[model samples]
Target chain A: MTTGEPGACVLGVDSGGSGLRAALVVPRELRRPDPVRSPEPVRTGPRGIDAAHFMAQLLPMARGLLEKAGGGHITAVAVGAAGLATLGDDLRAELPSALAKALGVRRTALAADAVTAYAGALGDRPGAVVAAGTGMIAIGTDLTAWHRADGWGHLLGDCGGGAWIGRAGLEAAMRAHDGRRGGSRALLARAEAVFGPPAGLPGQLYPRTDRPAVLASFAPDVAACAADDPVADGILRAAARHIAEAAAAVCPSTETSADTSADTCEVAFTGGLFRLGEPLLAPLREEVAAQLPHARPVPAAGDPLDGALHIAAEIAAGRLRLPLDSRMLSVHGEGVTS
Target chain B: MTTGEPGACVLGVDSGGSGLRAALVVPRELRRPDPVRSPEPVRTGPRGIDAAHFMAQLLPMARGLLEKAGGGHITAVAVGAAGLATLGDDLRAELPSALAKALGVRRTALAADAVTAYAGALGDRPGAVVAAGTGMIAIGTDLTAWHRADGWGHLLGDCGGGAWIGRAGLEAAMRAHDGRRGGSRALLARAEAVFGPPAGLPGQLYPRTDRPAVLASFAPDVAACAADDPVADGILRAAARHIAEAAAAVCPSTETSADTSADTCEVAFTGGLFRLGEPLLAPLREEVAAQLPHARPVPAAGDPLDGALHIAAEIAAGRLRLPLDSRMLSVHGEGVTS
Candidate 1:
């Protein structure tokens, strides 16, 4: 059901390095804001972005979202982003203002992708949400606040993410080169085919700079390699452990307590990485269960976009709150927190 | 490094699924044989068996020559093996009647891991040797044969080594149970904490098996997933191309051709799968050149046993022969002509 005319149309945006996405949430009770009813996703170049540049890309998308809403009166906008976003009055303001200006909202609430995702899934409740995309971040919410662990990215960390698996696959290739390991030749050849001559590998690393998708594209190769190849299997296993670790780290801050085995909020996962399904999720679920014996795992109802829309609805109703509890409101969508 | 009386030395035997290998060669040489003084390698495996497994393992300790020297003249023994060498074959049929009976010999030939290694590194000659340790094979020759290229195993393919990289890795983890495209959290958790459970994962997978190490043990991970992680950088770049392909597909009758380019056998590499070398010797060397261009990638001296020894003296005598063209031979290793 639409928030009704002059209906409070709220915009939700998820900005990533590759592109910026904006959705017009009209408060649907069944499923997410309709994809067909929504505006076509706007495409934008990833480079040359710092504040102003970020705004330029987002504003147009915001306008598109508005246009696609069939001229409804927009009340407010909420943005969930890949980078850090903390809202406060002092210096080192964490809330993402770059997106705020584009949305034309002075009071744009902000949260890290992890927190927003948890908000989207659990609705500001005490639960854990794992964002398994090109990168990985696990967010957990308790009664008062939220907590996180393991969002280090491809290089420093990011155990069970698309990027980590892809990078690991490439490393296996190099190990093969040095004669220290073994694997299928097809994997490396594919890497070379995609990245370019192995000789000039270093120079080719940053051709696109801000684009994580370039590297994320290799995740399938890692999954494929892991299926039959021991080396690839190891990489996937490591990624699972990393993601599980993040989930575990946040469990303490969730409804689960160290004193008792019962968890306050069940765990949930979102994004493409989780879509890898059994190979990754089964092990990950097992690992998480082993670590937090009392914690229960629930499949994510929808993606970050879906979560974003829920948050927009909450904001529109002035019911927006942090670390939502199940009692706060009803969730209506596929894979919503139980 | 002689261990006993001249006529009472232990034999070194290297039996592979491929063939039978025996050497009156002493066990001391199996650990650290004096290459300069080692005897030439011999081959007497069954029809299906060839130098691949038999030669790869035993030749290192100079088994062939000692066999020709006779086992009655030897004492204690050391041995290496492959496949069911540990269980399958009935000793009565697999071994020669005389040797199996041990009528006159104090000890029969032992496992020829050294010899097997030598075959890959030194082939029939003598010199430096290395290996990727998987189905991928890479042999090179200076005076003897040195080997490299994803060795023939599993499928008729090579890009890098590490059987698990493509087929084996995926199979081990069962492709993370994603129905052709996914990841396994359990497998990933097990692999990440190969040494022990990292701070985050639960201990469930640990109970199932020593999965972490088992999965990590595969080489393909190094090649496929290490691009972003320094731990796997060189590993991903490793593995060079093979000089030949099996067309006729007959036992030993397979016609082989080398992709001899501007860089012929003048520079090459040999191993199970090179750590940082992959796809082709050309691109691998080129990658190496990214750091040290002029550095010649001379083929491995031999498979490490008497491979180089077998050919070193022959080359010195200007009569060392190769089944493939000299240029192709230079690129790969001295081939065993039927």
Candidate 2:
């Protein structure tokens, strides 16, 4: 119900580490314009993702994009937030009414960034996608159900993720400093250069609110030292194995899916972690090949923002095939049926 | 310095989890009374252990104990602080002057609890002692120098400590919850019983300042499940291996020590972690035996407070033989010539 071309379109919003992005897309269109983006990441609190903070950032970006595109009826809206699974309650509860009131949007899909990564990677297909950055998560669908692995945060899981590798590398550095076994001289040198002396790392790290991000910052250092350091190399290899384990854990097995019609599914990798190149990816590829023989690795088609756009368009077209998961992926409002 | 029956005694203070304790100890005496105790763990801050909070707890307690002991010359003071190795700067810089001003103390030994445990276990003799509680550390002496391993706090190290076992057990529980490989149903049951649900464990942890202690609290649950759960058993065994590794790393090797006269040395295990009993200690013993064959395992002679007393006694008698280490153990008084 806008002033533009009376054509059906949907709004997509993604909130993640870098910032917030909102895009409008026409369903079934071959080409789409660049999304309006804001560099401010939404804040999270005890209540979860701050719904008010999110709207404060989103409304302007959405309106700006909509006005520029001369938008028509925004049939549905979907938002993908980084911590939607564990910390999205505030957003999930408040976003629908807020969106409908602000933009006359009735249909809303609140999806975890990993779920959006999955949709964007495989397009409602029965497959798995791993989005690994400071933290890592794998989401796979069997069409009827979704399987998830890791994303348990740096302490519990997120194994083989950026934080994990950095922690391992730093541990090796500390070991070297302590003259203990498993110490890596090269890694130790890198650690000293990056974080100052190994002795101060715990004090510098443990007290921080952004510990995961801080730990992940060192992952690249670990990767950089792999060529000359066995300890660093071993850390990367172990990370690869762990990542593969998560992938294998979540990928739909041929013998164990509601729809066993497909024996294999395409697996995709996304996120900043993969940018470390072959030091991490090469072993990751080997591990994935060894662990999930039935799955093939593929390049990710888009990012979480694009995934949000895709989900919104699917909802608008009444062709959203992804099963609704209460926490992982959910649809709100009675105005939409798919 | 005290109005007692012409005897030499020292004030030994232990600042740890349970609380603060001060004892007027007559070194080399076979019999000793219980230490005056205050149920207050000293606070830590950006500058490290709050020197003010520490003296507030120690001053009255030390005075009362000295008065109770019928007034004797407080020959020396040795404070074994739990975080002395890393967070002891304020305590080191401030405690000497504070103790001198308050208690007429001159000699002071500021030691990490691990060093205190080592002294309590092996005295000033050459050997290694593993102190594993919520965290773990191994300290050894070759007469001329001290060797430290692990004790890098839970994030970087403290492998095989209570926190490590608990974290591993919880990881298994999460694995079971996610239906992933390496799942432990027994651990899952225990985790849910203790932490409510495997899903909520991350939120329950990660945010707290006392994360290590909270993680370690689950160690007993893990220990209880070890008898029936291979996963739990494996976690403990791995912890044992890590502990052994640390011990091995720090224990003086016949081939590497400056003083190679001793063919073998005594090794002792200390702390609440050892109280987990055979479920953990049995494997730990096996791992230690395998790794530190040259060092014979021995029961600790006393607790850390006793160790503090011992260090104070040594300092007072001018017989302190533990090599000075800037962080591990530091002597901070000109009157001390040991």
Candidate 3:
């Protein structure tokens, strides 16, 4: 609860619509002289909700991690949450205070989950990151300024994300039902088994259901059927184009850049949809190359939690300068002056 | 409330997401020997809601119509309603009884709004009709069977409807906000004027708002700006393609037809989007023609109420044999035998 030893340990948390993940590690060890000597993080359960119920799950998880770590002084805690975008200005302003009250720590930081993904992908470097999971968004930073594309939720955007892919699959299935499109026999049978008869799809989707999650559940089926199913392949190709376009929107084109260092836009990919591997990445790489010739895909250095930990370390070292609004960053229940 | 006198008059109603339109006409006059002698319908207020609240508005409207029509004997009442597709089979089964109870009529017919549009456009002929208003759907028939495409609501489908156009415009506006896309200055200003700023749009749309209506409201702006705004033009082009694709999906291809009569597919377009006239129709016709070379656009003979009246007249004369299941048809709360 108190401000523990200065250079001791830090807690990093990543919370999303599905659940929460947290890790505890030594701040100094994260930047260890020898990469092999870096201490392994203590991982825990997935236990969180949207921003509304964030504290309810987060407080206990933080306390549990502190208790389990035993003896070490917890220096700071950094959290990246899925629902941060919905909080708006007032809630964002109060976030540090809320975290301070719950974790009982004087040093804390908060950011959107996308930020953590970006940090995990590129560290403090200037590059673009496309995160496509239940939702999709692209974030690019030239160190001095940041740009965002899409991630406008399932209704308006998230064109190439899991939900988008699933929606495409469902539409194709419906088309197949009407004999409008082929390659839906397997998809239709699978959908019927998972939900109900094709006639009941509208009832299952609209008004009452947790639409994003339900639609996202269909993404895997689309991927599975992509090999033999022309419809699924078409969806994947379209998704790749959308994702690439989103990335291109955020990442600077090589032709426009004056600085040679910033000329090559190193892009990174993350989230559940990427786990589909070659089916998605093969076309996605082609799309990125076609759309942004200078952009190159790089493997992510760590996950969002690791990014959270990295941010926590930077905050402790007084080296963190967020390319965000002052109001977007809070420390110990107060705004941080950049 | 009595079954009145048979073959006296018939009431036909069309209900949509925004409002309802009804007409009262004599069935015998609908089949007048001289086409010029057909009596014009008695029109009333546009009074209806989505399927959930349909009866609340519909019952009163029906009562008011009967009261206004006074001495005329109501032979039959036929209704075509929006959101009918979302209703499960059980609810559809119970609709006739509910309608009968409300109107105090034994002979009643019910169908989805698209069916009425199709009937109005094609007039019992074997052809396709695409209705693109607040929502979009294509209905096609080969005399023996029916085919439907899209109309999956604003969330999943309604691909080329007013809502779809509006959504595309809104997305373009948001993309402009993020500097991801161009040609949205006028669109953004217009949106801000109507919806009170771009940042607040997500809050206004998701969870709480009447999303379809709100999105559809933007279509007019998109149509208005299409000539000058690249973003608006892009939206219109995409909408045209989607609409054509949907129509093509339902309409039988020229190559597959063994019957020479079916080779030339006559297509009729209806709904508010078509009211945009040439901006929509020109591109839509081109796309439809390109995709469906055999299909030609036709001017609708009458509106959905006329179609409903046509069905009512057929029912009064005992000449109506629906291509639907017998259980779907009821006469005075009793199932009809084909």
After superposition, the stretches of candidate 1 with alpha carbons farther than 4 Å from their true spots are A1-6, A27-31, A34-49, A85-106, A174-179, A182-215, A225-227, A253-264, A323-338, B1-338
Candidate whose TM-score is highest: 2
Tens digit of per-residue lDDT, candidate 1, span B32-97? 343222233334344322333333444344444555545434333323434222222332233323
- Tell me the whole-model lDDT of each prediction, alpha carbons only: 0.46, 0.84, 0.69
- For every prediction, compared with the true complex, DockQ reads 0.02, 0.68, 0.35
Give a tens-digit lDDT track for model 3, residues B135-244.
Answer: 88898876656678878777667787998888888887777766664428878887888888676777678755577787898998988888888778878888898888
How would you order the candidates by lDDT, starting with the best? 2, 3, 1
Model 3 clashes, total count: 1
iRMSD computed for candidate 1: 13.2
DockQ score for candidate 3: 0.35
